[model samples]
Target chain A: MLSALPEAISILLSLEGILVLMLGTSLGIVLGAMPGIGSTVAVAIVLPFTLTMSQAPAVMLLLAVYAGSVYGGSIAAILINTPGTPQSAATCLDGYPMAKRGQAGLALGWATVASVCGGLVSAVVLIFAAPQLAAFALEFGPIETFALILLGMTCIVSVSTGSLIKGLMAGMLGIFLSTVGGDPILGEMRFTFGNWQLFAGFNLLAVVIGVFALSEVFIRASAPISNVSELVTFSGIELPRWSMWRGRLRNLGKSVLIGNVIGVLPGTGAATAAFISYAEGRRSSPNRAGFGDGEPDGIVSSEAANNAVTGGALVPTMALGIPGDAITAVMLATLTLHGITPGPNLVQENPTLIAAIFAGFFIINLLLLPLGMALARVAAPVLRIREGFMMSAIVILCALGIYFVRGNPFDLLVMGCAGFIGFLLRRQGFPMAPLVIGMVLGPTLELTLRQGLILTDGNFLAFFTDSPIAFVLAIAALLALMIPIVRNFRTSKKD
Target chain B: MPPTITKLKQESVIVQLLLLITAIALYLSTFKQGFTDAEAAQSPMFFPRIILMLWIVLNIIGLIQSVRHSNVTNPIASWWRILLVIAVTCVYVNLIGSEGFFLPSMVFALICLPLFGIRNGVLIVLFAVAVPGVLVLLFNHMLGMPLPTSRFTHYF
Candidate 1:
């Protein structure tokens, strides 16, 4: 990773690179500031346009959107008192109150500064950490990779923030959906049933856009349309005086650290990081007394942690081919669409491209400060558009995105069906994240498991007995799933 | 959460039961699709069958848990509106194949505005026209994506 920096820097110094950084960041901030669109939907919506781009720029575009959107969420949190993204829910507690007190500009200022610092630091962490992890991962064989995927699969239990059983069911459904195509190793079709389209399976992008984006439109369209529009007056951001930073530096640093650590852990994400950092700031900050009532420390805690997660989340996705969330899964899918298969060897094989991504991510975060201030005005008016128009636009864009991938109108039907199914499942308390992640992980899980079984002559237990790394990972996966269930059982028993 | 916990449990049960039946059907279909029941590692049916069996078990478990836990998340305002949106969306999809991208999307937006409670006629026409127009320009013209073209190719 270090060796590629010179070449990476040269790539980023090119015209296309600079334009991608600027446009992607600016577009990301605007989209993120939109109230209804979360980071996943935002990324999914922008995904198809990236297909026309080169490999490095395509990945960089999504990264910019992911980072910029996380920061952009804080704007809505402070100004509208409604979080633009789930990760910014913690920000609303103090951000809204601060805005209500006529310091909307200052509140946004604190959030912007904290977001930049967090994202910048996490980028550094990714630059140092992912390559080391990938290096260690080079030791893995099929069995160890299988065990690691099993560990990754334990994340379903964690991400199933709804009913555990329902989450597991959704995850199962996702795996099933992923298997709809032809079987890889056997050269025999599994579930295609002689349908030629099913040979390629459900397009991942179509499924992704359908479930995440279109389902959202359906859900929103089903709900009551509020007549009231209440947004705080945000003329511009006012940077906090240098003296205001005197007491908040520790809290900011701690929040960024919390974000980076939690982000690297599969299944845990920005929302978790934000809440944890906010709680920590409330506990240990010098300004703890003002913690809930428009405190700068509160905004710093939530905004910084969530933005830092933008970089932290990429570590596993890039180095190990394990996506911590749906957005990163989309990233991996983009890499695949561009004919670059993602795995531990991704960095080793595509050093210059990976370097470009890493360097572009850093630049995107740095661009956030100026873009956040500039785009807020542009986004404010756009936010006032009626939900009806917005929903229709989303459906059209999603349809177009699916069709353009292969000019296959059949994928449009696939997308529509997925969206409808997603809406139905969501209504039944099924979380969508697990299903998407399950689909993303399903192929690798099956491939590695089959290879491992072949090596062990169909003895499943030998997966644990043979490789110590596999053994440890298998044990970790067991504990990860079991501990949660045990705790829930104990809690219910106490209740 | 719905208006009542009872409603939530009922909906959850329906979903679980439906999935359970689907899993059973899918497991049977795996063999019908020509996957031989060859021993563990050798067959194409190996992983999917295991997954289907687990899916069946999980759905049954979920069915029981839904009735017992008595809570579901995400409240809906009206099922009628939901059905209406779904119906319009279906029409929109069919129309896209027959009519082309622009007209169907415009009609979708125009109808959708009223359904979502937007009443201003001018705003309706504006959004209806603008949505598809911008998409065609951005996706088709600019990005080289092939959106379906209608009789009025310029608009499409």
Candidate 2:
């Protein structure tokens, strides 16, 4: 790694490579700021261009986009209620409220700083700790994976401020909807209702776009259109004061660590990291009550963890030949398309290439600070735009983005239907975060639980005794479940 | 007569009841999903069944909570606006499938802008035309993804 560092720096310093990184980062921020147009779509759009370019510059471009887009997602989540990427969903819990309170600049600043910190740390981890982290993540099997997802589910309580029961209900509903397509294990068609489109089940992207973006449109439609001044007032990005950052270093560090560790695990994405980190921040912060109500710690925890996922995900992809998440899967495809084989021997075979990629990723994160601030300054004026024109533009973007997901018109209808369902659910005090979490993690939980049972020959006790990892995870899940109960009991006693 | 419940509470009650009914319907929908073997711990229906049961319980709890509490105040938007959004979206979707995106989306924005309270005709027309056209250029030409197009617009 030390020997390859010079070559890496040389390549990144090249004009073409630097230009690629700049272009990818800027375009990524643009796409990621648009509701429903996420990192996956952004990468896919640029994928064909990579086919014609050289390997070093090509990979750098995609990596820059990957890192930049994850950070860019928090912008929309802060400015509007809609999260640009699903991973930034937790950011919206605090971000939009801050924007509404005329602190959009401050919230954007917190997100920017948190994103840089997380991305930089993850890049360092990728260079030094890749193999060790990959080995650890590889030990997570069916039982351990299930327990981890259950641990994530405990976050529902944190997200649901007013009522826990309603949150769980919505989560359960989301999990059920996930089972609408063909059965994962049996390959049996279960809930298609004879529609061929239903055979594939509801697309997660479509559902997310509908519930968050389109439903927002319906909710906004009912209110009188106000000027952008009434929406979000901002001048320039406001970095937090030194006194404000006094004790929050621990929170930021912990969230970045959580994101990196979870990112190493295959299939768990940035959204999960954002949520788990937010919950942890809530648990550890002195201003815990201010959470879900525009707390700065909330923005830090979510943004830091979400951006950290970009590098953490690469750890498994490069070290183990496993795609850590969907975005990484697309990155893996790009690698294979460029005739580069990724696996354990990849480092030894292409040492300089790997080093260049890492160096480029670090540079991209550094660039994000200046680029993001500039973007925010430019975007602030968008608040001055007419409500009707702005809403209309957003509607077109949402419709077009969702259409591009699968190219099926049915997805459009699904978006409309989901918007209605989401609107009604919101009216009844049901939180959307839990529902999204359930949809995201439910299948993995069920698939692993059943697979573990099969492996154990239906003996549930084996889950606890089979491996220390599984045993520890199960205990953690149990504690997570019990914490709420214990808190409720304590509250009752105080009452 | 006893004091009438506020419209917001009434709406909440109706929504909760509708949820209960939907949960029941979801439960009934599972009848056609034949069960798997006994060795699988539970059949494919097991997950959905458990979920629907939870949905039912929660809806009932929500109903009780609604009656006992009168704190459902300050809904974000009014009822007609919500209906108008749903209707416009429905038409826009069907229009895209049958008539293509470019024209239908223009109509969607034109109609939706007014509903959203935009009264400037020039601004509305410019916006109605510009958004779809720019999106078409970007997604179709630059990204190489095909947008829905009918016979008339296919040449472009």
Using DockQ as the measure, the top candidate is: 1
State which candidate has the highest TM-score. Answer: 1
Badly placed stretches (over 4 Å) of model 1 are B1-4, B36-38, B151-155
Each candidate's TM vs. the true structure?
0.96, 0.70
lDDT of 2 by residue, B42-82 (tens): 57876677778878987788789877776444465556766
Candidate 2 Cα errors over 4 Å, as ranges: A1-134, A230-361, A488-495, B1-5, B35-42, B71-73, B151-153
Native-to-model Cα distance after best TM-score fit, residue A83 in candidate 1, in Å: 0.2
lDDT of 1 by residue, A1-495 (tens): 778889888878889888888888887787787787889999999888788788888888889888988888887788887788999999999999999999999999999999999999999988888888888898899999998888877888888886787778888888888888778787777677678988888888888888889889888876678553687787888888999999889999999999999989877889999999999999999999998899999999999999888888889888888778767777777777788867688888999988988888889989998888788778767667666766777888887677676777778888888889988887777888878878888988999999999899999999999889999989999998998899889988999
Instruction: Report the number of clashing residue pairs per model.
Output: 0, 0
Candidate 2 lDDT over residue span A376-401, tens digit each: 76644443466566566656776776
TM-score of chain A of each: 0.97, 0.61
Query: Which prediction has the highest lDDT against the true structure?
Result: 1
DockQ metric, candidate 1:
0.70
Docking verdict class for candidate 2? medium
Mark the 10 consecutive residues where model 2 chain A has the least summed lDDT: A378-387
Candidate 1 CAPRI-style tier: medium
**Which ten-residue region of model 1 chain A has the weakest summed lDDT?**
A221-230
